[model samples]
Target: MPQSKPQESPARKLLNILLLVVGTVTFLGFSFGPLFQALGPSESPEASLVTEQLRAQADGYRAVLEREPDNPIALRGLIDTQLQLNEPQGAIEPLKKLVELEPENRQLRAFLAQIQQDTGDLEGALEQLQILHEKDPKDSQVLQELADVQLALGRPSQAIELLENYLKEVPEDNDVRLRLAFIYVRNNQTEKAVALYDEMIAADPSDFAPVLGKAIALSSATDENLRAKAPELFEQAARLAPPKLREQIRQEAELSAQRNQPQAVESQETAP
Candidate 1:
């Protein structure tokens, strides 16, 4: 027997139909062009903040792009949304375009650099940061970002040179000092790291960056005496630290103490 025609539900019909109320409109000789084409919601935070209405809004923004391709507002919104959606690679072209459009806007360039950094395009990020640093050599933010990129690329010496110059100009910047000190430790200048931390501690004994940085530097010390100093410093940091970070400081102290203990090595014997 032939089966009866199946009834289509409204929801099924809706899914089968074109959604987002599409229409055609003529503008500047482009006839029957789509005014807007609604997109599906993306997982990007920039998009997610107003996700319930974002899809249609994004389409509208793109529609704006159709009319004025270089509209800074639309371009910025589109790239920001693209970034929020975690589409860093997709964001690059528009970001570059925007940077070209607003060559002097350092923040936009910084945003583009950040997108590059986030997408693992560290080289691109480094280039942008360098441009920014050259534009404003005294910009600590740019210096730190460039140093970070250098560190990520395993160019510790370059990072050291960059950060040290900035530190010389701004000796009161303990956070930068701590960062430089750690770089020093990584480059096998534990003594220099310790001295910088001592200076930081002298300025503000309660501040945690130097306290933690010094603890780490000392814990990795090959000299037994320096290694022994880590636990006491860690204890002091833990006591002065905020309650939220107190446990973390204590755990670090324990690890430092263990590193200070002498390790037993087993030597292999072979027939000569």
Candidate 2:
């Protein structure tokens, strides 16, 4: 009889089957991947090309601005391009021109205020914010922005006062409460911060922002008793937090507990 063909081992058979399956999957993916990618919900190549062309035009407009520094047309072109490009700093110069050309243009002033804030000039931004706030005292956006700049400029007390006054008028504004909580934390008024956060959470359990804030404030407390309270806050935060934030809250809770431990005492001499 002819010699029997060598039998494939089970492992070899499994490996062959795996390779065949992988080859089939790869072939199918190669055939359909391009079609799916082309018709996906993302922007089309033609749309991207158009965007690039528009960006190039914006760049050209900026070039014209550089050559004719004070040309109104160039100023307008630069302003439009900079706004489109999301370059607030670049928009500032043209906005200043627009303001100079039309001193009464409140809209330009508003845009300048926003650009100033974006550029980290909190004081300058505050001046603009003050102007806006004066123009419309009930404008919550202006009040909020002003209070934020005040806090960033190391004037938490001022922010607290502003928020307090605003909250008096807009008693039901949860946003004001949130800002007040942050200011309280910055001011090292932990109890007030925790209370504000608690009130906010009572209003809306789904508001994880305040929960996280409370956890952070609790974790930062220098008192051991207070720090001990942080674990519960962290647990709450972890429950509502995203995966990355949950891990961070857990780490912070651990670190806070470690920091709360009392230092060991050294033995004293029996006789002096």
Candidate 3:
């Protein structure tokens, strides 16, 4: 039999799919960016018929909402059908009411915020997220999302403060920590970002994420001292990443050596 390869730790396994995470990070990191892409080709021949079908369905859902404004089922249907028809502007108000009715529904709040973001209603999205964050201050999910919204609005320092404060309360959450460090990197807080990555690397050497992350953080730095150490960080990650991703990691590491960082990477756990 051919020799079997060593199994990867759970953290190491996450490295195998970094392409999806890191690639989408640039596209989805900002709430101002479209949350969902057009599902199929824009010019599909059958699109006209599909559009009519969706519009009819949406009309039906709205009729129901008219009779029962707080009806979750009808409200959800209207949001879904309108979005399917590529008309999020009409869906926002109904979504807001649905969110109000179901104050405890995290999914509803997120969906509403996503539609708001998609429609260029950044201030509205911020308002909704702030309510959710305040309603449950300890919700890690809300905290990360609110941070992303802040970053997208060009308030990275606020995002850093929010995540850092949350981290102090939940020190063991590698997921949030990873997100915080990524935000730091994006904000050009190279020293702080690298230090956080070092702490992560020390806690679980099996994780190549922070090592690769440090290289990413350093890629944007102007400091000669930080830039000098980026290649070593990249090299370290390449060796530690799983075999399946080793080559890709090495390529990114090589890029980092030239101070050519790829787009920022994000934790899938906290991706909007």
Candidate 4:
């Protein structure tokens, strides 16, 4: 008998929404590439009316919540109002109540985690994401967020291990693989970073990410031979890059060539 696939969790569904609302930006050192656009708060009240109107809305929601503590609508309204008022701390208790109202709701849990992250409560965020990861190890969005929290906590080795283990199960996930390579470069494992980029390039020669990633990895290498090859690869990557990115990669290539030129001249002048 064929088994049915599980429905997407609310937590995963809100990755784009809640992560943005909290302003959690993920950056890979050299940026293999942007995976998604910057998503954030929905249309907000104008600056002039923000304080007066939003604060009144927040108070209304609070009054309702005081009468009916488990009211999801009031809880959500309060959260939205507080967030719009730029008072994330004020949103926390209401968010906690919402999570308690539906302990099985992954979306609420994920939202709480993001709010915690935004509030600089990284350990709290990590604890929430850890539970999500344990419940769904193959949830790529959860895995990525978990790894991001690990990175935010200054645990690159742990982030690398988390991504690496997930990659073993889903080897074709280029996004995760690129993230892993970025970590390797950041951790000073340039050889490993270069190797991973080579693998990605071999898989798709026309893709500019690994090409640019390899160029970046090589450009930072201690090996002169490796560094010497960076400018040429950068140029190759520029040719393969999208029209929007082409100019930036071209400028990078030019800068790399200029930087290497003085070293090349020094080597030539000193040679017998």
- The per-residue C-alpha lDDT of model 1 at residue 50 equals 67
Better of 1 and 3 by TM-score: 3
As for lDDT, the candidate ahead, 1 or 3, is 3
Stretches off by above 4 angstroms in model 1 are: 1-68, 258-272
* Model 4 misplaced stretches (Cα beyond 4 Å): 1-46, 254-272
lDDT of 2 by residue, 215-270 (tens): 66776766767777777876887787665556755765676667657889999989
Q: Per-candidate TM vs. native?
A: 0.72, 0.61, 0.76, 0.75
lDDT of each: 0.67, 0.63, 0.70, 0.70
TM-score of 1: 0.72
- lDDT by residue for model 1 (1-272), tens: 01122444432221111111111111110111111222445678865666645446567768998999899888777765554444456668777888999889887787777667766788988898899999999887578668867877889899999989887798887556766776688778989988998898888877765676677777887887878777777777767766766786676567557656778998989989
Best by TM-score: 3
Misplaced by over 4 Å in model 2 are 1-73, 80-90, 100-108, 241-272
The digit string of per-residue lDDT tens for model 3 on 151-203 reads 77889888889988888888898767877877776666767878888999989
Worst 10 residues of 1 by lDDT: 18-27
Q: Please report the TM-score between candidate 3 and the true structure.
A: 0.76
lDDT of 4 at 85: 66
The ten-residue window of minimal lDDT in model 3 covers 16-25
